[model samples]
Every structure is written in C-alpha cells, then in structure tokens.
Target: MSVRRRASSVSLSRYARPGTPDYVTPPGDFCNAFWGLGDSGVDVLFARMRCAMTTTEELMSFWKERAILEERYARGLADLARFTIGKHEIGEMRGALDTLKNETAKQAEAHLIVANGIKTGLETPTLEFLRKQQQHRREKLTAVDKELKMKRNQEGYVVRAREKYEADCNRIKDFAAQSVLLQGVELDRLRIKHQRTLETVQANRRDYANFVRGLQEATQRWEDHWRAFCDGCQDLEEERIEFLFNNVWAYTDAVSTVCVSVDNSCEIVRLALEQLETEKEIGAFLRTYGTGNVMPDPPPFIDFENPDLQYDPSQPPSSHPANYPRQSHRFPTEDAANRNSVGSPTLSINARRASMTLFQPSAVNGRNGTARPPQAVQGGGSIPQSPSSQQRYSGGSNGSHPSHPPHAPPQQPPPPVPLQPQPQYPHPQPSNLSTPAPAHVPTSALATAAATAPAAPCPARTYTPIFFSLSPVQAIFGYTATTEEEFDFQKGDIIAVTATPPDGWWSGELLDDTRRQPGHNVFPSNFVALLM
Candidate 1:
C-alpha cells in the first residue's frame, strides 16, 4: 500500500480533496473499516462523538447542580436538627434553672426557719419569764435576809431582858434565902426565864437557816435556767450556720452544672457548623473533570535532536533508542536478586549473622550460658547488639571462658540427627469394630455444620419502663390537687405520678416529705411535662 504522511496540524480538507494523491494508509483494521465508508460515515461518527461530548458536559452541569442542591438540602436539615436540639437543650436548661431557683428559695425559707429559731431562743418569752421570776426570787431572798436580821435583833433584845430579870431574881433569891421557902420560888422563876430566852434564840436561828436555804435553792434554779438558755441559743446558732452552709453549697453546685451544660451545648453547635462548612468546601472539588481552562499539551516528544541527549554510560549495554525494541530487562531475575541481596558487599549480611550468632541461646559458654563476644567485621563498627546480648558478650569478653567470637572464623553447624528406620507394625484396630469406616470430611465441614445447625430461639427481652417522678413540678408548671387525700406540695418538692387519667387529671403520690406526708395526689395532666 502506498501512504502519505503529513503534519497533524494540516487541514482535513486537503486530505479529502479529489485529484490529490495524498492517500494515507489506515493504521489498523478499525481505521480501515471506518475509512472504507468514505466521507459521510466518518462525518456521522464525528458528529456523534461531538454529541456525546456535549451530553457529557450537560451531565457534568446536572451533577454539579445536584450536588449543590443536595448540599443546600443537607445544610437545611442540619440547621433544622440543630435548631430542634438547641430548643430542646434550652428547654432543659430552663427547667434546670427553674428547679435550681425553687431549690434555692426553699433553702432560703429553711434558713429563715432556722434563723427564727435562733431569734426566738435569743428573745423568747419563756426565757424572759424565767429571767423575771429569777429576779423576783432574788428580791424575795433579800427581803427574807432583812426579816431574818430583824428577828435576830429581837432575839438579842429578849436575851438582854432575860439577863436583867435573872439578876433581879438572884437578888430576890438572896433576900429570900434569908427567909427559907421564898428562896426556892425565886430560883425556879429565874430558871424558867433563862429556858424561855434560850428557846426564842433557837427559833430565830432556825428561821434564818430556812431563809438561807430558800435563797440558795432559788439561785441554783436560776443558774440552771441561765445555762439552759445559753445552750439553746448555741444550738440554734449552729443549726442556722449549717443550713446557711448547705444552701450556699447547693446553689454553687447548681450554677456550676448549668455552666457545664451551656459549654457543652456551645461546643456541639460549633462542631456541627464546622462539619457542615468542611463538607460544603470539599463538595466543590469532588469532580475534577473538565475543570481546567485548557488541557495541557502532551509532554514534548523525546527531543532527539538535543545535544544533551548523549548516550548515558551508566545505562545497561542493551538499552535501546526510542522507536527501537528493548532486548534486556531492567531488574535482575528474582532468584539472582535474592541470592546476592543478602551477601552483597554493601549489605554486610555476614556482620548481621555475626551479631545474631553472638546472642543465640544455644551458642553459650558452658554452665552460665554467657554469650560469646562478636568478632570485628570487615566494616569498622562492631555489630549492634541488644542490651542483654551486650552484657553477656561483655561478661565473656574478659577471657575467663573458653568461647570463641562469632566472626573469628566460620564454623560448620552440627549435623542433623540421622533418620532411623522403624520396625513395621500393624496399625491399631479401630475403636468401634462394628462401625463402618468413617467417610472423609471436607475442610469446610465445621463451617457447613455450623451453617446447617438449627438456630436457637432468642429469649424475649423484658423492657422495664423507667418512671420519672417530677422534681419541683410546681416550680416549672401549675398543679392543684383535687382530692382530700391528695397532698399539696410546694416548689422543689418531688411529685410522683402513679397514673394518668383521660379526664385531664393524673393520680400521683407526693414524695415531698418535709411539708406533707407522702400520699396520692390527683392533678391535671398538663400540669407537668414528662421528663425524658
């Protein structure tokens, strides 16, 4: 066949022109088949190729639009999800805040109650009455002391009167002694007078002792009351302090929890937004087809005319020029490569073997199993050994043991044990003589057996529904008990719902034990939301 070659850039019309002998031979059967159909067939094929390329461009546009729409839709959904979650979180936080507020208020009320107790102890009526009574007792004691002193003075006056009377009686007795019988009468009068005076003095002393006992008793009772009042005040103060501490601590904890929850919500939102942004950015580059302004031209052909394209001396002797067949492979054969790879002068396989041999368990010096020192290789550095191997090698290097270094010289390994011929014996009979010989099983027999095995029935799972008792239900919503048996609970109180009725009422038990006894309560169902 005759052929004409032309530059690829030449116009197609020149080749198709009649009377011009620029006929080019087809490169292959495919080209020949298309060429046999002449101009129209080739034109139709080219038109079809142009249509296909146009369709591909439309497809690309459609996919790009689809991706953009999908991204928009996904973002919308994500935004909706985030909004929904944010709303839910906000609701939870609100509920938590409300609960915390209620709790704080309740604590404050409790603190007030303690404070009242402390105040009452300080200025209580009972204590005041006791103090007044104590004061009155002291006055009574002072009055009694004055009365006793007066009685003592009166007794002293009577003693003085008796002494004077006794002196008169003695003088009368002296005159009567001179007159016999009259002396006995005078002496008897004097004796009776002295006994009366002694009796009066003894009565005054008894009255004084009784007054002193009464005063001491009053003082002791007053002291007891004072001590009791002081103790009660101290106790109330302690209780107040304890309540204050508890309230403050609880408030602090609630605030901290709220802070953590807020932080977590913020982080979740940030992460979701970041993910959406990253996906939107990456969606732009998903399809790289036809993105460039112009496709790059093929790498400039070999440039055979260049002066720098001199023969490479390092290349294999059989390397061929472009357009020429290669007669030699680039890499050595696998077996040859493997054989020389380890023993090559650059690799130093012998040194590695020497290092490994120095640490081998069996190659030891006698009883202690010490490692023999590694001999120096042709390379400058000693072979690197593990710490344990180095220690053993160091221990044996002292020349105390008769062991040779690994690289000192090559030595033959001990010959393997020779195989001994065994005496022929009949194989043992099968354990089950009556049973037929077992058939051979395939390698997949175990798997097949498992696959064929009947599956066990799954046991039914018992799911226990968790019941939530509202904590601080009233603080979050309104609730009123309709029955006499139902207990009315305040804020920060636990309300346990036992059942819900269709009548817009729910039957529940009050768990707030402080103000009311725990019992059933009927309240509107809408009074509280169900906790998740």
Candidate 2:
C-alpha cells in the first residue's frame, strides 16, 4: 500500500485499503484508516480509546453499586437478627426463635462476604485499570498531536517550494513572447532576462522535488510512529476486554457462592428446628405449672347430743404443753424447790414464794397444785403474813397473789384474824383460782377490818400455790411501749407479775386478755401498786 500525491490535495489511499481482520481492525475499525488525516484523525483515534476507557469506568461503577447493595443487605439483616425483642418464648419455642435469629445473622454474613469479594476482587481492579488507561491515553494522545504538528510544518514547506517553481516557469514564457515582437537591442535585453529566469526556474524545480521527497519521508516516519501507537492501543483494548470477561466470571461466581453459603447457613437452623417437638414443650409446661390432681378430704362431722369422743393415742404428740413449754411467748417457769437442779436458775420467783410462805406455825403443810387448809390448832395463833407479800405491799404495788388462805376443813382451828382478810383485800391473785376480791382495797385497812370481823369460815380457795408460778397483778394506770422491746397496756388491765427483779423493769403478761398474751418486755416497777 502507498500514498499517492494529487495536484489539489493529499490522498490516504494506502492505509484506507482493507487489511487482515485482526490487530488494528478490532481496535479502530472506524478510526485506523484516518491515521493519515492529521489533526482531525487524531481526534478520531483518541475518541475510540476514550470509549474503551469509559467502558472500564462503567464496569467499575457497576461493581461499586453491587458492593453497596450487598453491604446494605448484610447490614440490614444483621440489624434484624440483633434486634430480637422479647423472651416470652420458652423451652422448644425459645430454641426455635434463637435458631431463626442465628439463621438471619448467617445470611447477613453471606451477603457481606459477597460484598467483600466484589469490592476486592472486581471493583478495585477495574478502577485501577481505568486510572492507568486514562493516564496512558492522555500521554499517547499528546505525543501523537506533537508529531502531527511537526509533520504539518514540513508539508507547508513543500507547498511553498512548488508555488515558487510554477511562478518562475510562467515568467520564462512571457520573456520568449516579448523577444519575437522587439528590435535588436530590445529583443536582446528580453532574451537575457528570460535566460536568467529559466536558470532560476530549474533550481526552483529541483528544490521543489527535494521538498516533496523530504515530506514523503517525513510522512512515512510519522505514519510509522502513529501505526505503532494504534497497534499498541489495539493490544490494550484486547487486554481490557479479556480483563473484563474474567471479572464477569468472578462476579457471577461470587453471587453463586452466596447461594451455597446460604444453604449451609440454613442447615444449622434446620438442625435446631428438627430437635424440637410440641409434645416435649407441653411436658415441660406441665412440669412448670402442674398443681395436684386430687382434692383433699374435709374433716368429718360429729353429733353434739351425747357426743362420745374417744381419746385416740394414734401416736404420742411430738410434745406436750405440760412438758416443753414455749419460752419466748410465756414467762419462764422454774421449780423453787429444785434451784440447784439441772437447768434451773439460781434465784427465781418460786424461790421467793418458797422463802416467803405465810401460814400458822402449827400447820406444816401449804398450797401447791392442790391447796390443803392449814391444820387447825386448839390455841389461837397470829395469822402470819408472807414476807414476799409485805415486800410487794411495802413496795406500793398490789400483791402478786391472793392474801387469803384456804378455809380450814370443818375442823378444830381458831385464829387471831389479824394481818389481812381471806379475799376483799387489794391483793392480786390468779383470777382462775376462785372468785376474785376488790381490786383496790388497801391491804393495811383490810388487815384492820379482818382483825374485828367474826371469824367466819374463809371462802374455799382453789388457788394452787405452786412456787415460782406467775402471780396475777392489776395495773392502776396505762403504760405504752417506748421501744420495740417494751409492752403496751391500758388501765384496769390484769397483768401477771412473773418477776420483780432488782432492775426497775419487770416482765409479765396480760392475763385478762382473751389470748392471755405474754409481755416479753420488762415494765417500770411503779406502773403497778402492790398491796401493803
């Protein structure tokens, strides 16, 4: 193939001829023939290259969008998995919920893996390729344009030389025509001028031919360089297509791998689900919430009319009230006669009662669970007052028990009825023992009264004078608890003064109340008035 010169303009017939189907054909099927077209052709070549670069850019954008999609889907799924609400589900249902949550998280991870693969294996390389191509295209295009400018300058020089040669040939013809119409001297001068122009025309013709040859050589060199550029560009375009095709396979494979991963992830959830059953859950529910299935039997009825109750010693009671008495809620009991006995306090109320029993010296026997009257003596004797009672009376508080002694059994006993009466004195007593006496009578006055009254048979006494037993007393005034350990009571309340220790506080109980509530607290000594 060769370029042909024309009288008017240059022809690019050589490159325009059809060539092999490979190489430059694919890269510039429309632009390679225009390589000889100078600046205008440069525009065409770069435009084709730029289109290829644009395609790679578009591929990169596609990958970016896909990455974004995968990333967002992963994030959303992760949020859904993590945002589990309440735990009302239990047992098997709870396990199922957890499995579902894990399944969602696994799916999210799969999406994320796809996203990461696309970003690293596809988008990043495409983007880098675009950057490199863009740079190389610009560099190549600039070099091509620079070479084109130099070629244009050389072609211009060739045109100028051709114009000068044509003008010189026209002057020689004009000189020859003038010589035929002139005289000897005039004709001779015209010939001389024509001869000089002809020589100058020959030199100009040679210079024009040289300029044409030089331009042809220069054009060939320029075409060679431009051809090298196009060939290299074709190879680059091939590389771009090959790279893009491989990446397409990678993208599809990554998406398909997500399916495999999802299948694997769901397998875990399936396994968890397979283990659960409604029956198992129901059994657990029953175990958690079951009550008894049988009703308890109600107590049997009894006939009140001549009702015969038989004592059934089905088994001995765990304890008997007569045996292990309660300690905290009741005043402590003691055996006055057995202080040195095991498990006994050294000093106690029973001890006081034992040391202070009041009776006729002739009567050796005294009160206990059963009261035996003092045996009567023929001689009249003084009624002895209990030292404990005097202490209670002198202390300005009512007596802890009745001052009356049991009546003598229709026997020979006479007495000086002196210190106190059998009942009406303000001496405190256990109300359950017998009919009670006036609660506020002064003991000293009662003693005087009893000293004059006829010695009528004393009322029968039911009081068992067990030593250390609680002796009932009456409170003349109200008392309130000031601390957690103190007891509260109102006026006219009957209290059993169990102890009158040296400490001002004394312990007792409300014997008058229905419950017979005991006072665990120690009260002020002055709160009650003992009989004198």
Q: Estimated TM-score per prediction?
A: 0.19, 0.46
Candidate 1 per-residue C-alpha lDDT over 1-532 given as tens digits, one digit per residue, 9 for 90 to 100: 8886553433343335455233444422222222332223334333333333343344334434543443454444344433322233322343444444443334343334333433343224334433443454355434544544554455555555556555555655554554555457776776676566566655555555555555555545544443443344334334444544654454454435444444444434332322222223344444433253343444444567888987555754333233455343754454234333332221121122222323322211223332223335575533311111111011111111011111111221122122223211112221101111121111112222223334333233322222442222321232334333344544344555443222223345555444543223444333233322
Among these predictions, the greatest TM-score belongs to 2
Q: What is the lDDT of residue 246 in candidate 1?
A: 54
Clash count for each candidate, listed in order shown: 0, 9
Model 2 TM-score, 2 decimals: 0.46
RMSD of every prediction: 50.8, 41.8
Give the clashing pairs for model 2.
350-468, 393-531, 396-530, 397-529, 397-530, 397-531, 398-529, 398-530, 398-531
Tens-digit lDDT track of model 2 for 1-532: 8985452223233223355645455334433655443446665566667667767988899999999999999999999999774387678778877988888898999999999999999999998889879777778767766777778888998999989998898888888777778988888888888888988999999999999998898788778778877777767877888999999999988987787677656656654554455456777877877663444444445344645765455734342222354354333343221332312111122233223323212111123332222234466532211212221221112112222221222221233123443322132532212222212212232222223333333223222233342355555446555433246666567665544432234455565445343213344434444411
lDDT of the candidates, in the order given: 0.36, 0.56
Query: Model 2 clash tally?
Result: 9
Model 1 Cα shift for residue 462 (angstroms): 5.2
For model 2 the local lDDT of residue 257 reads 78
